[model samples]
Target: MEDKIKIHVLNTGYVEVDEALAFKDKSYNPIAYTGLFRSNKHKVKVPVFSYLIEHPKGNVLVDTGWSVASREDYKSHLPLKGYIASKPILPSGENIAEQLDKLGIDKLQFLILTHMHVDHVDGIRDVQDRAEFILVSRDELKAANKGGGRYIKELWKDTIFDRFDWNGEMGPYFKSYDVFRDGKINLIYLPGHTAGSTGVLIKNNGKFVLITGDAAYAHASWENLELPGIINDKVRTLRCLKWIQKLSKADNCVEILASHDPEVKPHIIEI
Candidate 1:
């Protein structure tokens, strides 16, 4: 029998942004997500998470957390506009490289990124040598390379990306990529958060765990069908949330984790 897959939920750092950015409401502010010119005084601090998947085939890491440089000077670490969008809070030993070192993860077979958001990809600099291949969705890479708004080209300029396409329909929107050509680990295209924002579906021993990387910000995101503040396509976001709602009800669904949920802590989930 194959060993159970162990998923380590690692919290690299935290980001403080406007509450609107995490969950959308009736507020009509167009640039609320940017944390600029918003009338609302509400700010929220949420943890940025990275996942280490111990699969039978190979070890995989999903997303890279904040870089250590941000801890010294966030202003210099990010562009002026990017700094205003989301302020990073990285303490000593909270970055991906330190966390990976503590976990004794010397190398990873694949580094699968859910999107190119600054918070998700900024830590790549720390782990570039640790991962053999870095993977991103084809559409995501295109959008990131275009360089506008939240996608900062500087963050991943030196990083070479291996693009993967969706070849089958297994999740919402009828788009999913079986990473290992097996049903155990799949990448579900949950766009709208970004051009190619993807979620992960991990199955082991007849159980499932879904990692919604900003596709839904928290359990309440799909529970109340509340869309995230920043959305490229409102229709697609809603569709993805609805599918998440349905899947959460399945008996085989062990847990659904959101990347920045304050309630989710660093833990090991074996499925």
Candidate 2:
């Protein structure tokens, strides 16, 4: 029986979205993330990451990176506007299917989509069949279904879904879903990046690791209180940033990984 919860960071691939979509007004400013939005499109390769959680109850996956089909064909699965907005690039054998195959993960207990953004949920086509149950922030699911240009409707199109929404909260900062109800794994609500952008908190034997997807683009945003580009609400995003800063201040927090942060690339963070 496995008692320890081990987390493997799977580097599925990368997607290029506008720099402004990443940092607040990175499109134009001296404080630009890369010092300048050189390209007319201002595109940057934000590494796409997924996590495989090996737990006592069952294996769980967080954020599927890209579908193999998308690599082969994008016109069929992605919105034309979104396809142009975020140019996803994947090398041979880097899709979610191959990544899971490399790890010999045939099945999963849970599949958590941090948000509905194309980079986060597009890979579902590659691994959705093996997931036992899905988890999502209720508001996110609603927003994705609203037919936004930022999301790929084809990803969830015509597919039946079974999901448990994260409806509970911890203190004033986080609304969470307590998986296993043992305080080991919590899907935290951190709105502002989207209507339902959320993070995950995992603890085992007193060690902790929290993964926030696009809640902050990199350590810079979360650590320095900088804002990301594609924001829904400035007020909400700032409040969420403060919450993250507060949580990171905890002595027990081992590491905080942002979805697109290059520093955390393809690294397994143990809990």
Candidate 3:
């Protein structure tokens, strides 16, 4: 096995929404997350990120970002509810498939989806056949397949995905899956953002780095226990945020990243 794991953080595109969508405000407006019914001044744009993990066993891609079709016409690529809530801005050459091709990555051992949100899985069509296995947590798959809100089946209707349950004990909730059957890579359950939202944890020697996929929208989400505007369960969101905060303080944790933190730029993280 390789002595180190290299994580390439790629910014595939951007999503424009109300500021409240990224960080909830004091107002309990149910539709605050949707940019509609709000002033244009409240709009904020944040980058959409995906990770490429170079592991000794195999290469894993987490959450394919916006598709080129979105850049052309998001309305045609996304459902009415989705396009209304958030606007996707994918620049030329930023599509997930385009990035992979630029990196000379024609295939992947695993393609994992943290959750089935439109911005995260819309590009599945571009790389579905490139992966040997494409997976999502059983709970997430069940929730997404219901086909409502942001979980639209149109995003992955033609793609086949394997579902895996969280059977291993690890992380804050003791609910995780050891992806490579080794301690190096793990999928930690972090619900609330979705029924089965997941975070990726990569460990090497005594160091570790966590990819918090929308479980925590930004550093402040965990640091201040601030919740995002869209949430499935308030209690679960709080629990996940608190645990992430604690995990961030661990000596072994080299880094903890959020999926759409504007402050985070595309870079490489090694563990």
Candidate 4:
């Protein structure tokens, strides 16, 4: 077997979202949290993270996090004519490229995007030319072109993606591709957060870590079974959540990290 891979959680930046956007049943709508009609002065800051995996075969990254330009002005990347999408907030130099540079890494063998959310793909331009290839699910490419507030394709329209495919079912939806042809790094399909939203399941040091990108707001949501406000399908999202919860209960799942969960700080897992 190949040597275990190391997983490093990189803090790219954060987003300031309406309380309703992260949690459901927390607003006047009853079935929702916050939106234009029930908008409130309250706000929640969620951290943005991208994972760096060190494998003997090659280096891999999951999600690009936020764009560097966002550090200057969070609203700069939004296409709403200055209206922010998720009201991203970041300090200067917290971008993915700089973070990767701090570790003395230059090229990425595989750049896996969890979904097309603005925060996840904004930094692609920074490493697009250097990375060997940007990989994303086939369904994600189609969903991004479907027109939505978060599916901003302009950031990475020029980059070619090697759409990773899998034909069997793993949990609630279509099966996942154990990228690398090993069980250590599996791209689990847990749709609903976005049409093609996916997460990474990594094995290291006899423990498995699931990096759930916006699948659940935080550990609390998954622990308490609370659904987030932003979703493509509530039913499917719930099923996905249950699927993850089931995995968490297993002895191998050491932890499940949420992309924007401030509670889960960045750390390195030795394998």
Candidate 4: deviation at residue 1, Å?
8.2
Model 4, 1-271: lDDT tens digits are 5477788998888877777778776652443332344344656778988999987778899998777776666555667622243766667777889888888889888899999888888888887776897888888888887756577767777889999887545656757887777667888888888888888888755778888988987887788888887788889899989988888899877788898887978899766
lDDT of each: 0.89, 0.79, 0.89, 0.79
Best by TM-score: 3
Output candidate 2 Cα RMSD. Answer: 3.2
By TM-score, the candidates rank as 3, 1, 4, 2
lDDT, candidate 2, 1-271, per-residue tens: 2277888888888877667667774444543433244565566787888899888888889998878877888777666765665777888888988988988989998888889888888888778888888888778888888877476677877455665665567623547888778788888888888988888889888778888888888888868888986777778888877877887899998888789886776877666
Instruction: For residue 71, give model 1's deviation from the true position in Å.
Output: 1.4
In model 3, which regions exceed 4 Å deviation?
26-28
Clashes of each: 0, 6, 0, 2
Winner on TM-score (3 vs 4): 3
Off by over 4 Å in 1: 26-28, 38-41
All predictions: root-mean-square deviation over Cα?
A: 1.4, 3.2, 1.3, 2.3
By lDDT, the candidates rank as: 1, 3, 4, 2
TM-score of 2: 0.90
Clash count, candidate 4: 2
TM-score of each model, in listed order: 0.96, 0.90, 0.97, 0.91
lDDT of residue 93 for candidate 2: 82
The digit string of per-residue lDDT tens for model 1 on 91-165 reads 899899999899899989889999999899999988988888898999999998899878889988789888997
Model 1, CA-based lDDT: 0.89
